[model samples]
Target chain A: MDAIETNSLGRRFGDVNAVESLDLTVQKGEIYGFLGPNGAGKSTTINMLLGFTPPSSGSGTVLGYDLEHESVAIRQSVGVLPEDFGVYGRLTARKHVRFAIETKGADDDPDDLLGRVELADVADRTAGGFSTGMKQRLALAMALAGNPDLLILDEPSSGLDPNGAREMRAIIREENERGTTVFFSSHVMEQVEAICDRVGIMRDGRLIAEDAIDSLKDRFDADSRLVFTLDTVADDIVPALETMNGVTDINADGNDVSVVVADASRKAPVIEAVGASGVTIKDIRIDDSSLEDLFATLTTGERPTSRHAEENAANTTQLIREADQ
Target chain B: MSWVHVARKDFADALRSKLLWVLSALMILVVAGISAIPQLLYIPGQGPAPGFDDGMSFMFTWMTMMVSIIGLVVGYRAIVGERESGSIRFLLGLPNSRRDVVVGKVLGRATVVAVPTVIGFLVGAVVILALYDGFAVTDYIGLLVFALVIGLVYVSVAVAVSASVNTRAKAVGGVLGIYLIFDLLWWTVPMAIYWLLERELPGSTDLPAWYVLVERLGIWEPLGILSGTLVDIAGVETVSTADRLAGDVPFFLETWFAWVIVIAWVAIPLGIGYYRFNRAVMS
Candidate 1:
């Protein structure tokens, strides 16, 4: 059974359509990543799912409960770490967790949850003086209070340091492994690419793409991006690389020219072509377009907004046929 | 119940909030100190505050002022502060309803403000009773209950304002503006109407409509109800012209119209606030 299912969920504020006719199905025990720009209605979709805001039209079911009629029941079974996580400063970390657990009528040790979040050391200290990251962790611990089946996290890493961001990703992965249906949203591509099992990309209040990370890369013709750091000067390489049979696109700054080669074998001939032109190559890197590249491609409107990226990326999956001798 | 759990958390949070505590303490000190001044700087003949016949007279004013100040300070932030801090989303994300949150906030804030008001009233009442040689059990009990209800009403109105507004500063201003406007009108309107009826119409035997309206306003005034009830209960014979005009309207506002007006203020705002809060998208 799907852990979460939204059928044509829509929301509007005055004339601005925050989310329109959005459909989603998240199965149990899978991590679903929601990727979008700052105002692509990503947060609005989550709010409607949680029943914080009633849908302008359509309906949904979370944990088998009606989105509108059974919102309280749905809320009870889900854990949410909002984008801006805030806790009452007067309560200690442990107390905050305990309060949340008690509120949910759940039986879980606050200590265990806080410890998992690495906040047990400051368990007794009031949250008033806590740093942003610490507050975020405390909020996470509170969300985990009832051992909820589904965890909805929005922008979980926006305010964290690099190490903190990595730690949050690890926690999310750990939770997913433990049978939690995770719906995580973020504008940061790296975090979602690293942790999400499947991703849904939203743009302009509509979901433009949804698939596994690999599938999105395969379908979008975006898996491999050709990057080069060269020693010699060759301004014509930019235009020459663009005109190559296998290269779909070319972007160059000075001697460093990157060609999006459709096939991996084209890499050697492209380098040879540069070398034959008396341009020495110092370094060459084939960087696969992770979900980030696909997201940028889809939302930046460089290409038409369609599900075609899925088919294109997958069909071109084979390693590029090398250039002929 | 979930509401109690919410209330407990509110209390815990309020205690931890230095701003709230400092404001409460400052209000208590100012009210208590100002109340005690008449005793310290008394004249031998203008004699014991004209009609200082009872503990209710003094305790009512002290507690009412404190409650209003508390309502303005702590209650004003109940919902708006959560919205401003972006914490309302987290709280609302739980299984609780908007009604439950409103009830919990009002109860929690009332408890906080009531405790201090009760304590201050008792201390000030005892001092006044000892000095004036008057005390009544009815007066004490009535004032305590009145203070609690008034505090809750203020909190309810303030919370509603908080929920509707997006910022804490706006909520504060809204509450203060509301209180100041009512308080000013509570006094000015009645007196103006009384003057017009007395001067403009010579043979008007009955009270003017506008005067009646102003007098009715006194019944619900947070400051007026306590003072008026306490005065009535204290068995004071007659109020002086200045004290009667300056003090009695708030007194009347407290006793006569206090409960009905206060209830309306709380109920209407809370209904609207809940509607807004239920649909608020936590960002």
Candidate 2:
């Protein structure tokens, strides 16, 4: 059975539809990425999942327990790192970790959890005086106290620098490797692609796309950026490139035109055609589609336009809007 | 219980902060200074009238005010400060119930407030004995109970205020406003209204019916309990101990409805505060 199944879940705040029809299925031990831009209702969805608030409509089951009837159970079983900094500033790092462990009724040692987060050196220091990254690390340590079967982290790397972010990612991966189901929400596409086994893209409180990262990459055809430096201005080059097979769009500026294509392998043929037109190519580069490209494409309501995801995002957004009413 | 852990942690954290010790010392010095009034202002064994108890009256008036001030300051931050510091979230996020959180907080802070007030009262008692003639055992018991109950009711009211407001500033403002309003209403309003009515109606009329309701309203006020207990200790004829402890009648029915109201004042809001706590959304 899936560790989490949120079916048609929706939430609205006053006139604002914060989350809508967010159907997600995260299997056991799978690192699921909840990708969305800021204000995409990522935090709201996580809040509902953790039973911090009730859903506006729809239903979900977490860890085989009914979301409606067993919310407290779900909260008990799942570990969370809320988007908001939930650590107490006045308390020492050890105190905070110990508090969390005791709250979870887990017999885990506070020193061990602090050690795992690499915060043992500063365990005696007040969290209030700690750096943002240190606080984030402390929050992570607190969340890891119970060895929860399911972990919901909302932008766990938000305040972390590159190294801190890398360490957080490693901790998440290690947790996942230990058979903990990881549900992480992030606007950073590279991190999502690097850490998550599967990805779900949300836009305007809707899950517009969901699939394995590679599969999403394929479905969106999020590959092929045409990079060619031109020797001189070429008239009708854009028109010609637009007419080519598998070419999506061509960006033409003063001295260069970068064409986006469906596949990177089609670059040589396009280069040959451009060269054949007696246009001197000073240099050329081919850029493949990345998670960043996929995120930008999905959030803009562009890439999923011709696929099933466009309708999915639309329907989810509609459901959220209606719930607000 | 988890509340013990929460209480221990709150106490430990409070003890570690030097500000608490500073505040406690300041409170003791100020209260002790105020306790010196009988010696400094009043003539010994004499007043306008020959038999009037000026010392008891002065002690009741000054000590009640001092204890009330202490209760207000110590209890004001119970909820709002915790919420602002994000510490409440850490406490609430645990497996414990909201009742545990609220109860533990109130109980913990009550311990903090009680220590100074009790010590201050004991030190003041010694000063009264040294400087002037001290009271009987009943007076000491009455003053102790009065101080504790006044502190508790104020703390409970403060907790209710804390739960209602979102910020520490608002909470302090709210509790201070409540204290001022209650002080004026319970002490001044009934007498003010009575004095006004006595002028219009002469000897022919009674105190207005609203005055009776307002007098009853005073029973629900914490300051009223403090004054009522003080009066009982200082030999005012409000209610007798025999009437209060009478077992033949149902306890609630036997007492001056004022004591019942005071008990409810302490219990009811505390119940609601705990309920609010359970339902409160912590980050």
**Best model per DockQ:** 1
Please identify model 1 stretches exceeding 4 Å from their true place.
Answer: A220-290, A302-325, B19-59, B125-134, B187-205, B208-214, B217-259, B279-281
Indicate which candidate wins on TM-score: 2
lDDT of 1 by residue, B202-249 (tens): 222344333544554542443354445543554433443234332334
Docking class of 2: acceptable
For each candidate, the alpha-carbon lDDT, in order, equals 0.71, 0.70
Task: Report the C-alpha displacement of residue A70, candidate 1, in angstroms.
Answer: 2.5
Candidate 2 global TM-score: 0.79
Per-residue lDDT of candidate 1, residues A1-325 (tens digit): 6888999899998999999998898889889989888999999998888877789999999999998898888879999887765667677888888888988999999999999999989999988899888888888888787989999887888789989999998888888888888998988778888878888878888877778877665654433466678886546667656666777656677777766666666777777776776667798876654445456655655542443333223323231111001
lDDT of 1: 0.71
The superposed Cα distance between candidate 2 and the true structure at residue A26, in angstroms, equals 2.3
Give the range where candidate 2 chain B is weakest over 10 consecutive residues by summed lDDT: B245-254
- Cα displacement (angstroms), candidate 1, residue B277, comes to 3.3
Each candidate's DockQ: 0.46, 0.32
The per-residue C-alpha lDDT of model 2 at residue B117 equals 69
